[model samples]
Target chain A: MKSEDLETVRMVVHARSGVAVDISKEYAIESRLAPLARRDSFADVGELVQAIRARRDEGLMWSVTEALIQGETCFFRDREPFALFRDDMLPALAARADRPVRVWSAACSTGQEPYSLAMIVDEVAPRFPGLKVELFASDLSERRLEKAQSGLYTQFEVQRGLPIRLLVRHFEKVEEVWRLSQSLRQMVRFRRINLLADLRALGQYDVIFCRNVISSLDPALRGRVLEQMAQALAPGGWLVLGQDERPMGLTEALESISGWDGAFGRNPAFRAAA
Target chain B: MKTCLVVDDSRVIRKVARRILEELGFEVAEAADGMEAMAWCRTAMPEAILLDWNMPLMDGLEFLRQLRKEPDGDQPIVVFCTVENDLEHIALALESGADEYIMKPFDGDILSVKLMEAGVLA
Candidate 1:
C-alpha cells in the first residue's frame, strides 16, 4: 500500500472514531481491510482506500473503523482485578451507606467483564439487603454491543477465564453455546459509547473499569479520555485503568491507591460532588 | 494440613481439583478408583473426600457404603463430584452416605462454598 492510502485510512479512522492507527501498521490495515474490500467487491486495497477517500462512503468507513476497534476479551480476563473488586472494593463500598454502589465496565468487549461484575455484585448485594447495585457496560462498536446484550458465549469463550462453578451456576448450556441466566443478563445494561464522546449522559459511577483501552489511543487522546473518565466518576469513586496505562501525564484528578497498579481513587480536591 | 482424597479416573480432573483444593489449604491425594481410595483410607483417612460417581474397580456408591462401615468413615465430609445431575442419581448418592453433590466442570469459588457448607473448611 502507498503512503497516501495509508494516510487516508488513518485519517478516516481517527476522524470517525478516536482510534489512532499507526502508519507502521500498514500490514495490519491491509489484513483487516482486505476482507472488507472483497465483501464490498472492491478491486483491491487501493480501491477501497480510494473509496474511503471519496468521503461519501460513511457506511464503509464506519464498518472499517468498527472492525479495527473490536478487541478480544474473556470472562474475568485478569483474576487480580476481579478479586480486588470482590474481596476489597465491594465490602468497603458496602460500608458507606450513602447510596447503593454503581459500577461501569468501560470498553467491555463482549459482556464478559460486566457479567463478571454482576456475578460478584449478586453474591455481595444480599449482604447489603437494601443496596441497589447498578452494572453498566459500554463499548464503541454496536456490533459488539449486540453480542454483549445477548449474553451468549461459545464453549471456547467461556473456557478462557470463566470458572466452571460460575458457569454451571449462572449460565445454562444452550446446545453447544452457553447462555447467561436471565437474572445475570438483567443485572447489566449495555450501551454503545465512545470514550472520546460526552459521558455525562451515562451518569456518574462509583467504580469505573477503563482497562486496556487507552494504550491503543495516541498520547493526546489518551490524556483527554482519562480526564473525561475522571469527570465521569463520582467523588471519592475508583478508576481502574489498564495495567500498562496511567494518568501521570494525562490527568491528576485521580490519585493511585497504594498496592494496586491499575487502581485509582478520585482525588477529592479535583472531584466535584455528583 | 487438612487432607483431601480426590477419586477420579481422569488425571486432568484430579489435577484441576488438586489445584483448586490446594489453594484452599488442603493436602491433596488422588485415587483412580474406589478400591484404591478405600486402601488409602484404611492406612489414614482424609479429612474430606471428593468422590467421583463413576470409575472402574469400584464405583463411588459402593465405595461410600463400604467407607461408612469403617471406623471414623462417617466423620469425613464426602462430596460426590460427577456429571450426573438427575434427581434419581443425586438421591442414590445421598442415600449411599454422600454428604454433598456437585457437578463436574466446577470452579474454585463454588468448591470453596461447598466445602464451607460441608464443614470441611472453616
Candidate 2:
C-alpha cells in the first residue's frame, strides 16, 4: 500500500525468486499475498510487508516469495508440446536404449508438466521395451511440491487441459477430487529447487522443461541463468521453454532447434565430456 | 452448428448437459432412453451422441450394438458419459464403438473438453 512496503516486497521477491514484480500491478501483488497475510495473522498487504521487513523468519520469507512467483498450471497445459514429447522425443530416446533418459520439469509449479510426461511414458514406453525414462519435477515452493507429490486434484483441476480418457486411466476418483495412480505418482521425483542456485547437483538432464521460467527472471540474471542451464544440459540434449519464449541470442551454448518452436538444443562446446 | 443428441434417462442430467452444449454452440436434442434415441436416429441422425448406460427397455451397450447395425450408423460420433468408471466398462464401451468416455458428476469444463476431444466441438 505504501511506497516503502511496495519496494520492500519487490526487492524480496526479486532477490529470492528472480521474478520482477510489477509495481504498476499493485492490486495483483496484494491479491497474491492476501492469503499468506491471513495465514500469518496480518490484516492486509501492508502489515505482511512490515512483518517481512522486521522478521528474519526464513520460512515466512520463502512462503511470501513462492506466493508471488508461483503460477496457475494444468495437466497438458499446451497440447503441441506434449504431442512433441510423446511422438518425437520418446521415439528418439527409445531408439537409443543405451543410456537412461532423464527429463526434468523445472519450476514445475504443482507438478502438472512432469506428471503429464509420466502419463505419456506410462502409455507409450511399454511399446519400446526397457526404455528407462526418469522424470524429475521441481519448484521453488515446498508447498507446491507437497501437493504435486500427493497426486490429488480437484474435479476442476483434473478437467483442465486433460482428456477424460487419460484421466480415467491414470487417476481414480476420490470423493470430489481425483487421485493420480500410484504408478504415475511414483514415476516422478518431486523436489524444491531454486533455479538461481547451482543446478549441477540435480545432475545433467537429457530433456529439460524450463518452460515459462526464464522469461520471468530479472533481465540482469537471464543470460547467466541461460548459461547455467546450458551447462546443466547433456550434449545434444533438449531444452523446452514456454511456447512464446526463446534465448533471443542471449548465449551461444543453446541454439533454437529448427522446426521446434520454443525448444533449444544444447551445443557440445558448452560443456566438456563428463 | 452441428447437432448432438443427449441420450440419458435423467431429466436433470439432460438439462445440465443441454445447457453446456448449447453454450458451446451445438444444436442439442434429448432422448429419454436408447429406444427413443434409436427412434430419433432412424428419423434423423445427429452428428454426435452423448450416450449413457443403464436405461429403461434398451441399455447403452445394446443401443450401440443395434445402432451400428443401422445404415450410416458409423457416421455419428458416440461418447459414453456414464457413472461407469471401471477399465472393463471403458474397454467394453470402446469395443462397442464409443469414441470417448466421461465419468459421472462432471462439470461444464470437463464436458466441454471431452466434447472437444471427441471432435464434436471446436
Candidate 3:
C-alpha cells in the first residue's frame, strides 16, 4: 500500500469504523488490495488507488472497504463465544431486563456474528416467556450489509463453521444454496454504521460484540474506539473481542473477565463515571 | 431405489446436483441446511450425501462432526461440494470425515465419476 492509498484507506476506515488504521501495516493493506487490483487488471496498487480516487461511486468506496476489511467469518465462528452467549450470557441478561433484551453486533461483517447471536436468542426465547430479544447487526461496508440482509450463502460458506442440525432447522433449500429462514433473517437488523461516528445516538446495548475488527486500527484509535464502544454498553454488560485481539493496554474501562472464550466487563467505576 | 441426499442452501447447485444424480439413476432428496439434513438422515438414511460447507444455522463442518458421532455414522459416502478451494479447507473436510471432496463449478461428469468411486453407482 502506497502512502497515498494507505491514507485513503485510513480515511475511509476511520470514517466508517472509527478505527484509525496506521499506514505502517502496508503488507496487510497491500494483501487486501491485491485481489481488487488483479480484478480491475490494474498494474499495481498505485493504479488502483488512482482509479478509486477518480471514481466517486459510493458503491466503489464500499467495495474497496469490503476488499480491505477482514471478512474472515463463517457460520457459528469460534464456537466458544456463541456457546458462552447461549449458555451463560443471554440467560443472565434476560433475568435483568424488564423490557426486551437488546444485543448489538458492532462491526458485524456479512451478518455472521449477529445471526449467531440470534440463533442463541431463538433457542432460549421460548424459555424466556415475556422477555423479547432483539439483535442489531451493523457493518461499515454497505456491500457486506447487503449480503447480510440477503441471508443467502453458497455451499462453501454454509460448510465452514455451521453445525448440521442447526442448518436444517433454520435454513431452506432454494436449489443448491442455503437461505436463512424468514424468521431468522427478520431477527437481525443490518445497518451501515460508521463506528467512529456518534455511537451515543445508537443507545445502550446489553452485549456488544466487536470482534476480529480491531487489528486494523492503531493503538490510540483503538483506545478511542473501545471507549466509544464502552459508552454504548450498559452497565454490567459484556464486550466480546476476537480470540486473537485483546483489550489489555487499550482501555482501563473494560476489565477482562472469564467467560465466552475471553470477554471484558464494564468497570463498575467506569460505568458510574460515564 | 437407491437414495442420495443433496444438502446445500444454494438452489442452483442443488438443481445441478439433483439433475446429475437423477440422470445417474439415483433417488435424490434435498435439504437446505445442516439441521434439515440431520432430520432427513434420521429417517431417510440416504446412501450418499453431497454436503455444502457454508450454511446458515448448522454448517457443513458441524454437520459432518455430528454425523460422525451417530451409531451407524459411516453409512453414507459423503462428498463435500463447496467453493472453498484452499488446500487447508480440503484437509479440514477430510479430517472432518468427508469421504470425498470436490471444488465447485464442477461438471456432471466429475460428479458421476465421484459417485462411482464412492460405490454409489456401478
Candidate 4:
C-alpha cells in the first residue's frame, strides 16, 4: 500500500484496462490482493506487486486487474431503465425492423443485464412474431465470463431483482441453487473484450447497454469509451448508460433524447448535416 | 391484508411462492393439490391464487373450471404457475379461465410483475 507500489499497480491496471484507481483506494488493492498473494505463495500484497514488477506476467497482471475491477450487479438492478426499454425502446425498434435486432450488453458482468433483456424479449416476442433477436454480452474478466456462461446463481444472488415469476419460468432449481434455463442461456453469446480495445470486431448493435462502466474509468478514458460505444451503434440505434451517466461533450454522434431518462439515440441531424 | 392461495403438489414450491408473496405484502395460504385448493376455496376465497398446472386429484385447469362455477370462485384472480411451456397447454389454460400464466422457477421480480399485470397487487 506504499505510494510507489500504488503507482505501479495503477499504471499496470490503467495500461491494460483503462480503469483509474485513486490513491485513496490503496486499501482496496491491499485487501483484494492479499489473498491472491497468499494463494500465489507470496507473503503479502507488496510481494505480489514485486512479483508482477519483476516478471511482468501478462496473465498475472490480468488477474490483478480483474480482481481490482468490481463486478457488482443484479437482475434488473433499476426498474426505470427496464420500464423504458419495455415501453419505449423495443416498440420503436420493432417499427423500424427490417431484420433481426442485435443487442449488446457491454461490460455485462456475470450476465444479468443481457439475461434480463432476453426475458423481456421473450415476454414480448408474441407481439412481434418472427422478429428474431440476437443477444451478445461481453466483459473484461475471463473469470466472470465463465460464471456468466454457467448460468448458475446462489439463492442470495437470485433474490436480488429477480422476481419469483422469472425465477420459476426461466430457471430450474439445481439442488440448493438456481440455474438459468438452457433456452435462456443459449440466447446470449458471451465474450471477453476490454472496452478500451477495438470494439468494431463485435459488429454494430441495434441497442447497447453499457451501464455502470464508463463512470468508473478516468475522465479521458470515459470520453474515448463513450465515443466507441456511440460508433458501435447502428445508424439510429440506441445506447443506454447507467442512470446517472450522460453523453455531454463526449461524442457528437449521440444526442440525449428529451424525456428519456438514461437513453440516447444516434444523432440523425448531426449525421445529416455532415 | 390481501390473501392468496398457492396451490401446488410440491411443498418446496409452495414455501418459495409463500416467501415471495409475503414479501409482496400478501397473506398466503397453501394447498397441495387442486382438490385441496378447491376445498380451501369453498371455506374462504382468497383474493388471488397462484395455481400450478399439474397436481394430484385435480389439475389446475380442472380447478379453474370447477372454481368458476362455485360461489365466490370468480373472485380470486388465478395465475397458472408451472413448468409447462407448450403454447397449446397455455392456450387451453387461458380458455379454461386463467387470469395469467407464469412459468416455473420464477423469482420475486417476475412474480411481482405478473401479479401487478393481473391487478392482484397494487
Shares of reference contacts reproduced by the candidates, in order, are 0.00, 0.41, 0.00, 0.00
**Model 3 lDDT, residue B61, Cα:** 95
Which of the predicted structures, 1 or 4, would earn the higher DockQ when compared with the native? 1
The TM-scores of all predictions, comma-separated, are 0.72, 0.84, 0.65, 0.71
The sequence of per-residue lDDT tens digits that candidate 3 reaches over residues B1-122 is 88899999999899999999998888999999999999998886888999999999999999999998986768988988888755467778888888777768776766765665456777
TM of chain B vs. native, candidate 3: 0.96
- Expressed as tens digits, the lDDT of each residue in A1-274 for candidate 3 is 5677789877766555555555798998887878878887999877877777888556656666677666778766766788788878888877887877878998888887788788888888898887788889998777788999999987666655554445656876677777899999999988888776767899988888888877766566787778888888887888888888887788777788864567788776654234
TM-score of chain A of 2: 0.95
**Cα lDDT of all candidates, in order?**
0.83, 0.85, 0.79, 0.85
Q: What is every candidate's C-alpha DockQ against the true complex, given to 2 decimals?
A: 0.08, 0.36, 0.04, 0.07
For candidate 2, give the lDDT of residue A56. Answer: 53
Kindly list the per-residue Cα lDDT of model 1 for residues A1-274, writing each as its tens digit.
Answer: 9999988878878876677888798788899889989999999989988988776588988888887774878777666788888888888787885777889999998889999999988878778776678898998888888999898887557655665456666877677677999999998988888888877777788899988888888667877788788888877688998767788877777789998767897776775345
Highest TM-score model number: 2
TM-score of 1: 0.72
Off by over 4 Å in 2: A268-274, B6-37, B51-69, B80-96, B103-109, B119-122
lDDT tens digits, residue span A1-274, model 2: 8989889888998989999888778898889889999888998879988988898577888888888885778888767788888888889888876888999998889888999999999889679888999999989888899999999987668767787678768888777678999989999998888889987777888898888888888888887788777877876788888877778766777888888777788776565335
Worst 10 residues of 2 chain A by lDDT: A265-274
Best by DockQ: 2
Off by over 4 Å in 1: A271-274, B1-122
RMSD of each: 6.2, 3.6, 11.9, 6.3
Candidate 3 residue B5 C-alpha distance from true site, Å: 21
Clashing pairs in 1: A165-B107
